[model samples]
Target: MRLFFGLDPLAGDKRAIDSWRQRVATADGRPVPPANFHLTLAFLGEVDERHLEALCDTVDDLALPGTGELRLDRVGYWPRPGILWIGPAAPQPALESLAGDLGRAGQAVGARRERRRFVPHLTLYRGCRVPPPAPAEPPDLPFRFRGVTLFESRRGRDGIRYEPVAAWEGGGFSQR
Candidate 1:
């Protein structure tokens, strides 16, 4: 399955972000559904079904750091990828450590790791051929994720949806 590990933003934050996206983003790109929003910790790509159990176990054994709030105060656009996103203005150590740990755990289970440094951001739009204009008023969303979720990316009649297959909350494993 196409899978990834990520932090799911709380409902209030998601609503605020979606409202901001509607207010500021142009019609040029496909606006990401708020329900599908996430701050990716590790992109595991495709894993064999046979290895799913091992992958989950590997992730379960990880030592996750305590959760904290992330202040997402900047807007950014990638011209090459034709994407727009919002992210923290500065580095967040708690987030970085969690992501790094998850990346290693996924790799230990045979999932390929990204070669580049991790940038914590939640994608706002996709398919922008040109760079989007900066918002007149900058975003200042404070996000606190309750847990890390293992999400399955699925495409169906209604476009793409991210379904949480499992999650670790407060350092405890839980099925979703």
Candidate 2:
């Protein structure tokens, strides 16, 4: 099955992204839905059922320091073959390190090694096409990081449906 690890954007947060995207789209004549906002950790191309299960188990054992609220910041495009997005913005070092570590673990577990260096950004869109016009300088948005989720992505009618297969929460501080 095709799978990847990522931080899921919550429903409410998605809405916020959507609103910002709408404004950008209006100004640039293109927009992105909130559904597209996600920070990928690793891309496990294809794995047999057994290997897939092993991956889930491995992920289940992993944990993260969820101490800070991740703010969605920055909006930029990858300009090369065409216009692609980087985020809703850049990720914190903690987030970037996690992605890199996951990439390494995936390789050790017999997963395919990714050729591209992990760039911590949420992909907005991809195509040979470009926006009607350059977007107004991408807006700055922010969000809080409540926890990290281990999602099981599957093909669905609309697109890829990512369900949180397993998750461990440990970011909030204990206060008296």
Candidate 3:
């Protein structure tokens, strides 16, 4: 199955992100559905079913630290990937550390370590024929991450959809 670890934003945050996308996305760009909006922590490509249990176990044992409210205030466009994304203006140490821990857990289960450094962002649009111009400034949206989820990616009638398979709650403490 195609799997990844991620965090889903609250409903209000999703609406704010969608609103921003409507403002800057080009006609040719496909906006990510609000229901599919999430901040990916680790992308574990195709995986064998046999390894799934071990992967889950690894994540269950992660030592995640408490993080304060996260802000998705910066809008950015990556020309190479033709993706529009929203992210924080500055580095979020707690969020970064959680991603690192998740990455290590994936590696322990034979998942490939990503070569690029993790940049915390939620995709707003993808496959833009013409990249949208960067916004002059970011919108103000603040939220707390409630949990980390294991998601299975699959092709659906509309397009690719990410469905949550399992999750671990986070609220200034670790949860299995």
**Residue 33 of candidate 1: its Cα lDDT?**
95
lDDT tens readout by residue for model 1, 1-176: 88899989998899989898888766478889999989999898887767778777877777764455788898888776788999999977777887888888778777888787888999998889888888877888878887788899999999999999888875647565
Taken over the whole model, the C-alpha lDDT of each candidate is 0.84, 0.58, 0.77
Model 1 alpha-carbon drift over 4 Å, by segment: 65-67
User: What ranges in model 2 sit over 4 Å off?
Assistant: 26-33, 60-63, 79-83, 86-91, 131-134, 171-176
TM-score of each: 0.93, 0.74, 0.87
Clashes, model 3: 0
lDDT of 2 by residue, 63-109 (tens): 56553445555555555534455453444677767776666656666
> After superposition on all CA atoms, what RMSD does each candidate show versus the true structure?
1.5, 4.9, 2.6
User: How many angstroms is residue 148 displaced in model 1 relative to the true structure, after the best TM-score fit?
Assistant: 0.4
Candidate achieving higher TM-score, 1 or 3? 1
Itemize residue pairs with steric clashes in candidate 1: none
Per-residue error for 27 in candidate 1, Å, reads: 5.3
**Best of the candidates, lDDT:** 1
Least lDDT summed over 10 consecutive residues: which range in candidate 1?
59-68
Supply candidate 2's per-residue lDDT for 93: 73
TM-score-based ranking: 1, 3, 2
